[model samples]
Target: MSNDVAILGVGMHKWGKWGKNFVEYGVKACLDALKDAGIEWTDVDFVSGADTVRNGYPGYVAGATFAQALGWTGARVASSYAACASGATGMNAARAQILAGMADVALVIGADTTPKGFLAPTSGDRPDDPDWLRFRLLGAANPTYFGLYARRRMELYGATEKDFAKVKVKNAAHGFKNSYARYNKKFTEEEVLNSPMVSDPLRLFEICATSDGAAAVVLTSMDFARKHTANPIKIAAISTVTPTYPNTVIEMPNFATDSSAVVGLPDAPFRDSIAKAAYEEAGLGPEDLDLAEVYDLSSALELDWYENIGLCKEGEAERLLNDGETTMGGRVPVNPSGGLACFGEAVPAQAISQVCELTWQLRGAAGERQVKGAKVGLTVNQGLFGHGSSVIVTK
Candidate 1:
């Protein structure tokens, strides 16, 4: 019972403020993926769509919506919503169907159309909703949370503003030639520091923007892959675990962490557990990774991902960045596709975009940003609430 699923093809609609219906972007990506896989739309028997709650009715029934848009042939459909982790959830669903012998070929897709400015909670007046309360009561938008994390790094790890700027500089350079990236121009440390400070120590350029984009992947069982392609990248693991009780970290849109008075701390923190679970499922470790594409909502957050994904020890992420170990041609190049730094946050589409980058890197087709000879790559992302996402892919 090998839990492997082949990634036959991956595709994306260029990330930007396209100002079009999300379904349009989704369909384009799906068509691109189908073409890349060298298969007809009829070949797909399952459709797993990452949902967008902000987009009204079509977004709610994303799986069926996409099926209809693609000229439906009665494919079984499922929709998933896990905030930013939506794409990974959809991918996992498709993989499960393939592994369960329910479907030989499947399409996993995500697309988003976001508004300008900081992402806020849904339109509501509910007093119990922490998402709305955070904005209403504390005025704590996303950048506020990013600021808190950046300040924590400075105070705890002796990281400086320059250290955070370096992350932007590095990623900007990596994505300079990425055709799909929205903000591809490279920046210098001085330019990053000179930008307006939106959230305390974090400059405006250090934060990821909200944009419109789409990404899609075609997946099949290992047996089907062997007949379709000579050497296809296989999904070694997909971890969408939730947090354990007494989660101490006060994450996004939450005012308080779980009280530790009743229950003791778990064996691992929520973030650490994300990649650890994936590694366990894949029987691999950080040492096995050739590269990684992590959710870098902010420049400082990228440093946190290094430790969370076992790339380096806790508090050593600054040193890893300064040492150039996490950059291209380094020990483990993280975010060679430039990450959120260049592409911005397209919500549901982002996690799928990360996997698309991994597939290209594994095939050594990632043009200028390619991590040389990359064989095994990992993608890690987290979203609102306890949603955790991580995927391991091997060539």
Candidate 2:
């Protein structure tokens, strides 16, 4: 498909446990994006915001709250929440508005201060919330699910604990150069293996921590973009896909996977399904990609995406890592901006931040972490359950 929308600007508040209000981060990121675009808040035709549930009332109506903060000009407003997919969902909302002629320019925002330790349900009571039930009843913390994936890899693919630790080591090395990363310290493979285990099979470094951060982007119609500057990176496709019925694999906040007793399992897992949609929409295969930024909640999960995103054949993910094919000098570098290993899991902010990294890399502006001559990049953010977002961009 042809590109219709241009990412004129991208910005973010550094990811860390700053112990501050979510609004502060959002406002900071918005201002930076607006500045980068050379477009004032008053000039924006619309503003889209991602919900940060921990903030109570403000989160429920994030679009207006952010609008008011930036001196409201009656820009069209939209809000969305989908576990970790909030940022990309907001981007999609903004992009759709522009493509539909509802607006010429839009600012997409996703900001949050993640809770300490495990993220619990927003409401105090109510078994209706799957997050609450998973914590209260099953004691299935997020790490437990990460453990399951890791153990499964060990059993099926012969992936060892050292392989998992290698992911932490690689990401930490990448994080050391990223100023926005929450943890900039380089991790040694030995340190990762020696660190205390969180959930069995997954060590401390193997899991991402929670952090406070915000990221925003200015997306505009291609016509408006040409008037502003030359050589703009365009958003080629945005894929938000859910699993087909009978999703057999276990996911976060869910007690159990869907039963295949009645219906046989689908050919592809939800993660691969998400990437497949993106590739189809962009009219490009995994071989065409210059790089990818994936949700690496765990080391094993990072490897899973190597196969899930079709960078390699199923079960051949180990070869990619072993051959240094996923590194900066590799055929398709993954997570050159450090990713969650350094950025942490800021539910709302992370998805947009991944795109920000993509924008910089595509523009040849990502200084130390630059993917040489990068022309195409994709960001894959999978939320709890079936909510998944994948964005494909090109220069």
Best by lDDT: 1
Model 1, 94-158: lDDT tens digits are 99999889999999999999898889788868789999999999999999989999999999999
Q: Which ten residues in a row have the lowest lDDT in candidate 2?
A: 118-127
The most accurate candidate by TM-score is: 1
For candidate 2, give the lDDT of residue 379.
Answer: 90
Cα lDDT computed for each candidate against the true fold: 0.94, 0.89
- The alpha-carbon deviation from the true structure for residue 35 of candidate 1, after best TM-score superposition, in angstroms, is 0.7
Candidate 2 regions off by >4 Å? none
Q: What are the per-residue Cα lDDT tens digits for candidate 2 across 91-165?
A: 999998998888999999988887798776666787898888888898888899999998998899999998888
Alpha-carbon runs more than 4 Å astray in model 1: none
